[model samples]
Target: MITLTGRLICADAAQAALVQLYLPDHIRLTRAEPGCLSFDVVPTSDPLVWQVNETFTDRAAFDAHQTRTRESRWFKETAHIRREFRIIG
Candidate 1:
């Protein structure tokens, strides 16, 4: 299994609006994918930061997620967003 943990940071007040607008779609699409074990978006104490916690069955599943996000218009539009990820043991 592979876990993808990350925090997404948006500029100023745009975080909440972006989360409300785009997170649901990301959740629905990612969770529905074949190898997705879980996909969740959580709020952070800082208004401009949000966390993304995702698990996939394997590396292939992770790759698929990368492809989907890269091709997504929503992600492209939010290109200014900053993110960081860590691998879990």
Candidate 2:
């Protein structure tokens, strides 16, 4: 199994709301992908901070997720946001 944890912090309130507005589509598409064990995005105490927790069946699954995400509109829109992540097993 593969686990990915991260935090995405928007540049400002407008950007944060933009991310929140598109999260539902992002979650739905990601959850529908094969080998997706779990994908979660949670709001932190800071309004601009979004916590990410994702799990996949294996490295291939994780790679596929990364590829798909990189091709998504949500990913492109959030490109300027600060993101930090770590992979674990």
Per-residue lDDT tens digits of candidate 2, residues 18-70? Answer: 89888899999999999999999999999999999999999999999899999
Q: What is the TM-score of each predicted model, taking all chains together?
A: 0.88, 0.95
Please give the lDDT score at residue 17 for candidate 1: 82
Give the CA lDDT, 0 to 100, for residue 11 in model 2.
80
RMSD to true structure for each model, in Å: 1.6, 0.9
Q: Which stretches of candidate 2 lie over 4 Å from their true place?
A: none
Candidates in order have lDDT scores of 0.82, 0.92
Error of 1 at 60 (Å): 0.6
